[model samples]
Target: MIMTKELWEGNAAIAEAAICAGVEAFFGYPITPQTEVLEHFSKRLPEEGRVFLQAESEVASINMVYGAACAGARVMTSSSSPGVSLMQEGISYIACSEVPAVVTNIMRGGPGLGNVQPAQGDYFQAVKSAGHGDYHMIALAASSVQEAIDLMVLAFDLADKYRTVVIFIADGAIGQMMEPAEMPPLRPVRPPEERVAWALTGAKGREHNIITSLYLGAENLEQVNLRLQAKLKKIAANEVRWQEYSTEDADFLLVAFGTVGRICQTVVREARAQGMKVGLVRPITLWPFPSARIAELAGRVKGILTVEMNAGQMVEDVRLAVEGACPVRFYGRMGGVIPLPDDILPELDKLDAGVASGREVQS
Candidate 1:
C-alpha cells in the first residue's frame, strides 16, 4: 500500500521526485543512511511501470546505470560514502561516454566505512574529482527537502540536456529528516524507441551508434578531451548558482554549501540580531561552484570563513575564489558531526581577528 503521508523523509521525497520527473530506470545497491531511497523506489517504481534493479554492489549498480543511460533511459543511482567511492570508476566511464545519468550521494562520514550519520565530507569527491577524468558533472547541492525534490528534477533535465552526469549531494541528516514536501507535477517518460538517434538499438535502418569510452589514437582522444573541457567551461559559465544572504553590507562572510549552508543562514539572521555585520554565501550548485560570486564577495567583505563537515575540503575552493584578497579561515567537525549555528558563528568571528592582524589565517 502506498503511504499517503503529508510528511516525507528526504530520501523518500527524492524517490518520488524521480518518479514524477519521468525517471524510467534505477540501478543501485542499498546503503545507509540512504537505503530509504532504494526502498522507496523498489516499492513505487514498478507501480508506475518503471524498472528498478538492486544490483550486487555499488560498482555493478553504476555500470548498470551507465548501460541503461546509453540506451537513453532516464536512470539514477545513489549511495553513501564508501559505496560512492566504489562507484568512481563507473562514473569515469559514464563521463567519457557522455551518457546522461543522475547519481545522488546521501553523505555519511568516512575514510573507509565511516558511520551512518550526516556529514558534508564528499565536497571534494563530488566537485574536485568526481572520477578519473578531466570532465565535470553538473553538481547540485540541496538544503531542504523541497529543494532536493526540485533539484532531482533539474538534475535529470540537465543530464539529458548536456549528455553528462549530474550529481545530487545531500548529507545523511537531509536524507533521514522528515519534512513536508509537495511532489512536482508528473511528466511522462519519453519512449526509448524515440531516442534511436543516440541510443544503442540494433541497427535496422540507420547508422549504428557506438557508445564506448575507448579512444586508442592519441590525437582522437585529445580532441575528445578538449570538447569535454569546452562543455565544462560552458556549464561553469552558465550554471554557477549561489544565494547572497545579508551580504550587501557585511564585514565578514561565511562560505558554505549543502547542509552547512542552511545552518549558516540562521547564523546570519541571529548575528544580525546581535548587531554583527556578517552574511552568508551558500553555493547552490557545487561543481560549477559559484566561485565567481565568492571572488566578488571577497572584494566586498573584510574576510571569509569556510565551515565544513570535514577537516577542510571546500575551503581550498573558497580560498581559490578569494585569491588572497581577504583572509580565508576554515573550521570543521569531522566523522559524522553536524555543525550547529552556534558552532559556526565563532568561526566567522575569527575571520575578523585574522583581518585585524593582517596575518593570513593558517588553514
Candidate 2:
C-alpha cells in the first residue's frame, strides 16, 4: 500500500522516494543543502538491508556508483555544486560504460568553492557535457518537494531504461521547502537478467566483454559517435516534459526552471491579477529542453521572459525556440542570490509596455 506523508525539505523527499523505488545502493559525500539526503538514507536504508556508503570524496563515491551499477544494482549519489564538479570524471565514465545510475545535484553558487547558497550556475555543466566527450545526462529539474520525489523516481527508471546517468537538479530554496507528499510503495527488486552479450560480468564460459569509451581507430570511433547521436535523437523525441500556466490568452510568457520556475508562477499570478496577460513555461526536463513548446507559444505571446538563478543560460534556448518571431528577455540573480517576485514584476511590466509600444525589447 502507498502511504502519504509530509517531508519538510525537498532533499529528504528525494531520498525517501529513492527508497520507495527500491534503490539498492547509495554512495556519496556530504555537502550543504544536500546533506539531509545522505542523512536520511543512512538511517533508513540500513534497516531495509540496502547498501549506503559515505565515501572519502565525491570522486570516490561516483566511482563506487559506477562499480555497483556495472553489477546491475540500482545505485545513486548526490552532491551540491562543487562536489558535483568533482564527480564529473566518474559521470563521464558511467556514461561511456552505459551504466545506469541516479545522481542528484542540490545546486549552490560556484565556479570554485563559491558558496553553499543556491544558484543555477551549473546549468551548462549538467545539461551539456560535464566531463569530456559527446554525452548527455538526462537532466530533470524540481521546483517543489513533490516534484523532487516524483522526478527522483522517474530518474531511476529512465537511467536503467536508457542505460545512462540521470541528474536531478534542485536549488536550496526547493531543497529547504516544506510540503505534503504521497509516499509510493516500495518496489520489489528483480534479480539481474543473464548478462547481455556486452555486460562485463566474469568471462566464465562466455566471450570476454569490455566496457570502454576508447575506440583507437577513426572508423570505429565514428561508429560510436553515430550510435550515441541516434540515442540522443530518440531521447529528444520521447522525453521532453514541461508545465504551462495561463498560456492561452497570455501576451507575456515566462520561461524558467527548477525553483526559479516556481517563483515565476507566483509572478504570473500577480501579473494576471493586475490585468496583464501573462503565462509561464516551466521546463521539467532540462536536457531535452521543452524548446518546441516554447516555439509554439512564441507565435501567440508578445514576448518571453527567461528567469533563472544564473545570469542567463536557459535564455539562449528560449531565444532559439522563439526564433525571431518574438522578443526574448532575461532576468536573473547569481552568486547565491535569488531573484524576488517583486524584482521580477518590473521586468514583466517593462516587457508588457514594450509590446504595447511596437518597439522590439530584448534582454
Candidate 3:
C-alpha cells in the first residue's frame, strides 16, 4: 500500500486516524481544542455509513460511548480537560464493566474551566485515576501530530485486546498544531460476528452474556476487583513502552511525556552541544509507565529532571520509580503554559550545579 503523507491539524488527524482504524461509532460534544475531532467525524463517518452523533453534552456522549461499547462496537469520543472531567463517571463505569472503548483527550488548561491553551495538567487524572475506581485504563500520550495519529490506532487495538477503556492523551498544542503525517491504511470495521462473546447482542443459540460494573454483593465485587487487578498487572508487564534518546552514556536524565517530552529532546541536544552528558526518556504508555526503565537509569545517571506542563504530577511517579537512587528534580509550567527548551535548560543547569556541589536537588 502506498501510504501518502498529508498535513493535518492534531485534532483532525486523530479523528481521521480513528476512521482508518475502523471506528464504527463516534459520540462526542463540541469543546475547544478538541471540537475539530468531533466535527471531522461528523462529516467523514456519515460519508462512510458509520455512526456519528453529537450528543447534548459530554456526559451524554460518554454514556452513549458506554452503550455502544457494551454492544461491542468500536466507539470513541473526544474532549478537552473540563469536558473529560464531565465524562469521568461514565469512564469509570466502562472500566469496571470491562468494555473496550477509546477516549481521546486533547488536554487543555484546568483545575476547572481553565483556558483552552495546551497543558498537561491532566496527567494525574489520566494516568493515576481516570475516575472513582481502583481500576486502570491504558493511557497513551502523544507528543506530535504523527504520534497522535499512530497512537489513536494503537488505542483501539489495545482497548479491544484488554477489554478496557484506552485514553489517547495529548496537550492542546498537539491538537491544534498542524504537521505532515502518514496515516495508516484504512481498515474495515469488525463484523458483528467478530464481536466479543460478552457483547450485549441479542441472545440466540448461546447462553446470554451479562456485563455490568455493578456488583452489589461485597464478596462479588471483591472477586471482580481481583480479576481487574490481575489484568492490570498483566498489562503493566507487557505494555510498558518508552523511547530513550542519547542515554547510552549520560550523567543526567530528563524524563517527560507528551509535549514536554518532545521539548526535553531538544533540551538533551542543546545540553549535549555544550559538552553536558544529558539524555531523555519519554514515556509513551503513561499507565504501564516504563517505571522499570526509569528505575534502572536512576542507578546510573547522577540526577534526573522531570519537566512537565503541570504543577508537578508525573514527577511523583518519577520519584517513586527512582526510589532515591539519585536526585529527582521537577520543573513545570501550569495553566496552559508550554515549557520551551530555553526555559528548561536553566533547570537542567541547576540540577547539574546541585549534583556537582553534592547538594540535594529540590523538586
Candidate 4:
C-alpha cells in the first residue's frame, strides 16, 4: 500500500504508527518529551473508536495497560524517565505474567526527576530486567521519526511473538525532533491463540485460565526459570539487529544507540572525510544486543569507542560485546547535555593516537 510522507515529531509518529498497527487501548500520564505521544493519541485514537486514557499516575496507567493486554487487546503506554521508574512495578508484573504490551520510555535525565530534556541514562534499566526475577523485555531503540514508526510496529509483533513485554526506547531529541515520515496502511495482526488459552476474558464455556507469576514451589519456579533462559538464548541467537557504516576497512569503531547513534553517524561521516578509517556500529535492538556482530568486528578493528548521553551505561555493554578482544573506551556527557559531533572529533583523534602509541587498553 502507498504511504503519504509528512513531517512529524518522533512521539507523534509513534502514536500514529500504533494507531495504524491496530492498537485499541492506550493508558499513560503526562511527562515531558513524551507527553506529545499521549496528546496525539488522545485526539486521534477516539476518532477510530479506540480508548485513550490520561491516567491519574504512571503506576495506574501501567496497571491499566496490564489489564487491557491481559484481555487479549493491543495495548500501549508511554512516559519519561521518572515516570517510567514509577511504572516499574507494573512492568515487572507484566513481565512475570508473560503479557504482551508496548511500553515507550522517552528518556530524560535520570537517578531522580533530573530534567525534562533528552538523555540516555536508562540504558541498563531497559535491558537489565528492570522489574525483577529472570524476566527480559525486548528493547528497540529509534534514531528518527521514521524509525519510531517502523520500530513501534516491530515492537508489537515481537511482544506478541515472545509473549513478553516490549520497550520502544527513544530519547527526548528523537521524541521532539520533526522529520519526514510515511504512515503505512494498517494490516490486521492476528491475535495470538495462546492469549485466548491463558487470558482472563470471563469464564465462558471453558475452565478459568489464571495469569500469575507466583509459583510457590521451588521446583516449579526452577522449571519456569529454565524455560525463560532457553527463550532468551533463542532470542540472542536469532533476534539481534545492528547497523554498520564504513566498516569495510576501519581501525576504530564508534558504538552508540538511540539518538546518540544518529549523532555518531555524522561523526563517522566527518571522520571518513578527514581520511580517518573510522566506522560506526548502531544497535537497533538493545536487549538482544547485537553482541555477536560486535564481537566479530572486534577481531578486525583496532579499538572501539562508546559514546552516549549518560556517563557510561552502554559502554559496559560494548565492553562485554568486545570481550577483551580490543580496547574499548568511553566518552559521554550527562544530565540532559548532548555531545556535539564537533566535540567528539577530538576524542576520536585521541583514540587514534592512543592506538598508534602502542599502549592499547582492553575495555
Instruction: Name the candidate that leads on lDDT.
Output: 3
List the candidate 1 regions with Cα displacement exceeding 4 Å. Answer: 1-5, 359-363
Q: Once superposed on the true structure, which residue ranges of model 3 sit more than 4 Å away at CA? A: 361-363
lDDT of each: 0.88, 0.88, 0.93, 0.88
Model 4 clash pairs are none
Worst 10 residues of 1 by lDDT: 1-10
The sequence of per-residue lDDT tens digits that candidate 1 reaches over residues 222-313 is 99999899999988888888888989999889988888889898998988887889989988898998888888988988888889889899
lDDT by residue (157-272, candidate 4, tens digit) is 88878878899999999999999999878866445553556777777888888888888999998988888788778877878888999888988899999888999999999999
Stretches of model 2 off by over 4 angstroms after superposition:
192-198, 361-363
Candidate 2 lDDT over residue span 31-140, tens digit each: 99899999999999898888999999999999999988887788999999989999999998888778889999999988798888989988998899679888899999
TM-score to native of every candidate shown: 0.96, 0.96, 0.98, 0.96
Predict model 1's lDDT versus the native.
0.88
lDDT (tens digit, per residue) of candidate 3 on 248-322: 999999999999999999999999999999999999999989999999999999999999999999999999999
Output the number of the TM-score-best candidate. 3
